[model samples]
Every structure is written in structure tokens, then in C-alpha cells.
Target: MPPQSEVEPYAAIRRDARSGMSGRALERKYNVGRRTVVKAIASAWPQPRKKPPPRPSKLDPFKPVIDEILRKDLDAPRKQRNTVKRIFARLIDEHSMSDVS
Candidate 1:
């Protein structure tokens, strides 16, 4: 997000543009981006998009290996159900993968 110091000028720019101010003149007067001036002329309200959070799990990098192990376990005996610990262990044993916590 940009500082209010910068964002605060948008309203004034939009106001000027709304009253028949040209995009080029708005750009020159406000010293904002050309796109910003154009958007200001098009609409009075600003709608800045909020970014979603990133999701990275320790298990993410090893999804294929985990999926294969779990798929194979589906055919195994009832007593051989795969657990989180077992999955981690199998990953360690088979892939020499030790990056996970």
C-alpha cells in the first residue's frame, strides 16, 4: 500500500479531472501516472486491489512424493494406514529429503 501522502492527492486529481480537465493536463498538474490520470477521469472512486496471503507449507515441496506414498497405501492392509510421522519417515528414507521441520 502507498502512503496516504501520495494517495490523498488522488481525490483532488479526480475532482479536477471530473470538471473537464484533460488527461494530459491532469498528468502534468498532479505529476501522477498517465494511467492514474485516465482512471481519475473515468471514475471518481479509487479501488486498489488487496493482495492475498501466500501459503507455503513444509509439505508443499514434497506433494508428489506424499501423493504417491498415500496412493500406494490405499492398497495396503488395514493395519498399514499411513500416518504423518510415517509419511515424513518414508520421505526421509526414499528421497533423502531432510529439508522439512
Candidate 2:
């Protein structure tokens, strides 16, 4: 394994690369791997990191829309009731919705 000091330089190189510096330029400046430069560039910048254990779907922004539609369907008279497929179709057609699953 490489020493921690070596790792620190790559982190710095990556930070510099994110600020409009090219990886090749970083490699020349830092004398590290082009691959290392690339890795550094990726690591240095702030990114939309994935949430751990992701937030529950119940709290999702579209939840209210889905709940309202479902409630309306469930409350309708049995003789003219909507099925799950029909409900989903309505959501797609009218609300431009989709299931993440």
C-alpha cells in the first residue's frame, strides 16, 4: 500500500484539477499517475453523493399526488371503480408519473 503522504498529494492534485486544471496538467505539476490524476479529479470535487439507506418513499415529493389519486379510486363506487392498472395509467397519462420500481 502507498504511504499516507502520497495519498494526500493526490487529494490536493484532485482539488486543483476540479478548479479547471486538467488531469495532465495536474500530473505534470504533481508528478503522479494520469490515472491517479483522474482519480484525484473525481475525488476532489463536491458531488451529489448518494444518501445512505435512502429516505423512505412515503416522504418523497410525489407521495401526496400518489396518495390523493389512490384515495379517490378507493372511495369510488364498486360498480365504477378503478383497478390498480387503471389508476397507474391515469397517473401516467394525467400526472406524467412513474413508479421507481
Candidate 3:
């Protein structure tokens, strides 16, 4: 993936080229491909990334209980806060949640 830093410069070069410079001049000035300069001039902003909706998790059935456990932990000391293993243990031991291995 192109970093946002790189994208920012492409937009700048595109703007500079649009101001008066030729395509070849912009390519030489920015040390980039002609196609890349064309792409830069086409859009100033990074295109929004499309992400798929989340699939349901194996732990979805127990999310409410997990939320309660995490909420309670907020008032506890940092060292005493529950880790994932601790939460898993608590879920299995207290709620008789089984099937996870």
C-alpha cells in the first residue's frame, strides 16, 4: 500500500504541474512515471478504503458477559485487570461456557 506521505506529494506535484508545468516536466521534476502523474492529477485525496462487514465471531454468544467483565475491570488496578486468558477462564468457569479449545 502507498503511504499517505507519498500520496500527499503526488497531489502537490499534480497541483504544481496543473499550475503551468507540462506532463513531461512534472514527471522529470517528481521522478515519477507519466501514468503515476496522470493518476495523481486525477485525484487529490486518497480514495476511501472499502472494507467488508465483520463476520460473526465464535465468541459472539458471550459478548454481553464479556462486556460486563471488561466494565468491572475498569475500576480495578491495572495489574489486576483481566487478560484474554483470564476472561476466557472466567467465561468457562463462571458461566459454564464450553466448546472453545
Candidate 4:
């Protein structure tokens, strides 16, 4: 396979071409292969379908509180930051959440 860096830029070039520009023009401007230009253009040309939102994790209910905790404790030492154990403990003690996972 080509290196990751080269592949990503080629994809971007392809996306740009599909939006309006010709493949030959894109290849000349971006120095990408013609095949790469074609592929990117084809993928982006079609209107993408909307995906449904993912289900929230058990921890998600506590996100607002978690954000508050993080904000308040931003200057605290790393060791004092919330751990998985602490999160589980808080979920059980405060929110009455079960070990769903």
C-alpha cells in the first residue's frame, strides 16, 4: 500500500474534483494519480445517507455532571482526576446505575 500521508491527500483531491472540477484538471493540479482522482470524485459525487445516532452508554447519563467535575478539577493533579473505578463508584452510589456492561 502507499504510505498513509500520500493516500489521505489523494482522497482530498478526489473529493474536491467530485464537487465540481474535472478529473484530468484535478490530477494536474494536485499531482495525484488519475485513478485516485476518479475514485474520490465518484464517492463524493453521490449524496451520503444520514446515519442514526448511536445509543448512549450507561455513563452518558452522567456526562453533564462529569463535565462539571472536569471543569472544576482542571488545575488539579493528574492522579486526582477521575478514574474508571471512581466513575463506576459514582454511578453506583449517586446515580444508582447497575453494572450494565
Task: Name the candidate that leads on lDDT.
Answer: 3
Give the winner by TM-score: 2 or 3: 3
Tell me the deviation in Å of residue 39 in model 2: 29
Candidate 1 residue 73 Cα shift, in angstroms, is: 1.2
Please, what is the TM-score per model? 0.45, 0.35, 0.43, 0.39
Q: Write the per-residue lDDT of candidate 3 for residues 13-97, one digit (tens) a residue.
A: 8789769999899888888888878878887865666899998777888999999999999999999999999999989999888
List candidate 4 segments past 4 Å from native.
1-53
Q: For model 3, what is the alpha-carbon lDDT of residue 29?
A: 85
Clash pairs, model 3 backbone: none
RMSD of 3: 7.0
Off by over 4 Å in 3: 1-55
List, residue by residue over 1-101, the lDDT tens digit for candidate 1.
85575356778887886698888888888887898876765666676778989878877778998898889989999898899898888889888787776
In model 1, how large is the Cα lDDT of residue 50?
80
Q: Candidate 2 — worst ten consecutive residues by lDDT sum?
A: 40-49
Q: How do the residues 17-71 of candidate 2 rate in per-residue lDDT, one tens digit apiece?
A: 6688876788888877777776666665434457789558733766787688778
lDDT of 3: 0.85
Itemize residue pairs with steric clashes in candidate 2. 14-40
Question: Mind giving the per-residue lDDT tens digits that candidate 4 earns over 54-81?
Answer: 9778777777877877786788898788
Cα lDDT, all candidates? 0.80, 0.70, 0.85, 0.72
